[model samples]
Target: MVLLIGSSMFAQSVSAADPSLAELKKVLQSQIELMKPELKGKVKDLSMDTKMSLMAILAMHSRYSERATLRQVMTEVLSDYQSVLAGIMTDNPEHTADSARRLANHRIPVGGLLPYLGMENISDERLAVLDSFNSSVEGNALKLADAAEAGDMVKAASLIGDISSGCVGCHGVFRSQPGVSDLLSLK
Candidate 1:
């Protein structure tokens, strides 16, 4: 009876370790799918906005890697970002102002990744990047979230690039962390 009780407790403990990775992946994928058309429509420059979005998504991917099962899903999501950015960059350089307006609607989700990453306890260097980004001209432009809502893709894309640069700078630091090199390389 003692051994059985011990085994049962151990099983429960193991089961409670983390949420199902598959479920997490599914949720993330669904979110992306739902956001895509909206994303394509609202941004003037897909190249810049896509890169910014990928950086944000990668931040989430970093968190998902904490679990083994979710690692595969994380990889898939990262690949999607890469592919989308590549396609956008390679395709057209010009878009209708109306399309840009539509894409701007996704600003909330696009920008929301910053706080999510912060919740993961961003490094000091990363925090600095975020600060710099917030104070930048482009960042200031985004403060005109109202302008973006009014279909100002020009202002929105500019701000989005600044945000993307911040993410890249931080990720550069994140990847260089002593033990994370191997993990980052998977992307």
Candidate 2:
């Protein structure tokens, strides 16, 4: 809410002057950077009791409800990746590189969550798994981008599979509908 209010104020200031898109983006990025430290402080070094409290608060976040957009972006990037592979197989580096660049440049808001640390350096194990998953995804995405930029279709082809594995693995763990309650399943 604060951020939105701040952004609106910033926008109002610029709207009268008709700032360019690039200028608005720069202002937005600067505002976000200014907020980062304060934002990070809120969630950092939480106690166990705080974690429990946060669980209640977070229950209202609609995170699962938000996954559809993430999935759609992933599908688009994956589709571009498929064309990249086809281009590689057909010995068309230009097509392969073009598609790969398209995949690399895809952007969206709210990619996903990262792991959190608590007061004693403890973390939520589930979020830890997601952090690992995100790392794998990021590394593979970078490699895929680099390979494509260098017109190394063979490398890009291999990376697409690796990146797909990261996505599949994360979805399997977090997105699956379980047959039993975790407590009952554990027993």
Candidate 3:
């Protein structure tokens, strides 16, 4: 198939470029699938050379083991968020706020292929829009903790909503399964 030919050809060049072609493929495929949505059909648009270039960038940027760790980190973070949400519902604002502060204090490893890249694209342009979302999540967590400590239920509830907006923004793109963005293109 065309994919095999492309991959095979790239493999030779990549192998010559470096002896880690197999590892490169593994890392590239996993990461690309992870960010397939954000890439926005960029793969299909790329020349073999460009795709190879992207693959090289990916291979050099983050290791496969590192990605696994990143995934685990996200899993833990989301689990923590669930605990925080539950605490809020049960009138346990102090606990919820404490949980929220965990996220606020953390740098929040991003999801998808660009986990280590920190919201960068192939062009290496910082996705500036995501910065605001990050700030919102961090900022609201602090405010939520403050509101909860003050026993201001109304303000705490409002801050939770604000925090959720940030989560929604990130999860919509990053948490979805591979091929989701190109579902219509799949036969």
Candidate closest to the true structure, highest TM-score: 3
Rank order (by TM-score, best first): 3, 2, 1
**lDDT on C-alpha atoms for all candidate structures:** 0.33, 0.46, 0.51
Instruction: List TM-score per model, in order.
Output: 0.27, 0.46, 0.49
Using lDDT as the measure, the top candidate is 3
Instruction: Select the stronger candidate by lDDT from 1 and 2.
Output: 2
**Residue-wise C-alpha lDDT for candidate 1, range 118-154, written one tens digit per residue:** 2233333333354353344223333434444555545
Q: After superposing candidate 1 on the true structure, give the runs of residues whose Cα lies further than 4 Å from its correct spot.
A: 1-146, 176-187
Q: What is the lDDT of residue 143 in candidate 3?
A: 83
Per-residue lDDT tens digits for candidate 3, residues 4-121, read 1124456456554555776655554444444435453544444565454445434433323322334455565577677667767887878878877765654222223343332233
Off by over 4 Å in 2: 1-68, 109-123, 176-187
Error of 3 at 168 (Å): 1.7
TM-score of 1: 0.27
**Model 2 vs. true fold: TM:** 0.46
**After superposing candidate 3, which stretches have Cα over 4 Å from the reference?**
1-68, 107-126, 173-187
